[model samples]
Target: MRAWLFSGLLVLLVGCATPAPDSLYQQLGGQTGITRIVEDMLLRAAADARIKQHFVEVDIVRVRDKLVEQLCELSGGPCIYSGDSMEESHTGLHISRSDFNALVELLQAAMDQQGVSVRAQNQLLAHLAPMRGEIIER
Candidate 1:
């Protein structure tokens, strides 16, 4: 009885202690701000030959707009995410962890270019951190 009671209390405490979702758009300035970051990030990603292969079959212009829209929605800005789910979008792409990491580095570089603060960066990253699991299939 005591052990069960202790477990219930622990669960309650954990639930109460959980923080709210970290919305990136609010942190890195706002709506227009995230668009600049996405633009820069895509540019950086395009410049790298290794990662560029992934975009060979893509429409770069559409990709950029979709990315901006997705980011805008993700950061709590007034926008909708029109892109497909991670599994659906990446299907047959064989994206590896290294490729994802490279893109992430480029993204961080772009965020830095826009002068996002450290705390905001971390919050943004944390918001995006879960996608890493869903995105890297290879």
Candidate 2:
């Protein structure tokens, strides 16, 4: 009986292992939802005087489109990114780690405002976290 019970428990555990969504964007309600979050995040980031200097030289509206496109593609959405490479686009402007972190914070806040669950937000962030290596100044 004990052996049978153990076998049953193992079977149950194995069957419960459903995979997470391959694309976080889909899990977060897709393009419309993602677009809303990105818009909110950019607005908040722009309002931040400490970090707005990064955008002083950029066309914020154009950058906004690129950012939305990039994030959508990275999250496994159907959109393709047509922007310059991170290294190329960010070159010559000595961007600091603090700047990146501030942007991340604003993104998280925007997600919160949009009613995304913490787990979904973290999962999306995890997908983006690796870009820090490429985005930060050496």
Candidate 3:
């Protein structure tokens, strides 16, 4: 009876143990996956009438590099962002809520295209959502 009780308790303890946390970077398929998502997003954004104007004056390659860095760092990958602060970058744009929503939809669609899990997409979105105040000028 004592041995059986000990065995049961051991099983219970093991079952109740917390699992290790999964990294968002790994969930996003590491750097390669991140790059694919960014590329898709940029293409979608460029074609989007609501947001395409914003890309008109910018160097698309530079923009892509910065975005890749930003998303990599945001998702716990090995990259550093070399871009201006969110507020600094958008200070003169006078961006509207609709523009913001348009970009977000494009990002979501890009993530979906890359086969990113809904949970991983939500995780990235939650991390970025706080930047709205800084990015939206109007």
- 1-138 per-residue lDDT for model 3 (tens digits): 999999999988765442224778777777788889989999999999999999899889988888888988888776778999999888998789999999999999999998999999999999899999999986
C-alpha root-mean-square deviation, each candidate? 9.0, 8.8, 8.2
RMSD of 2: 8.8
Alpha-carbon local distance difference test for all models: 0.79, 0.81, 0.87
Better of 1 and 3 by TM-score: 3
Off by over 4 Å in 2: 1-23
Count of backbone clashes, every candidate in sequence: 1, 0, 0
* CA shift of 121, model 3, Å: 0.4
Worst 10 residues of 2 by lDDT: 14-23
Number of the top-ranking candidate, with TM-score as the measure: 3
Task: Identify the runs in model 1 with alpha carbons over 4 angstroms from their true place.
Answer: 1-23
In candidate 3, list every pair of residues with a backbone clash. none
Local distance difference test, candidate 2: 0.81
**lDDT at position 137, candidate 3:** 86
Return the top candidate by lDDT: 3
The TM-score of candidate 2 is: 0.77
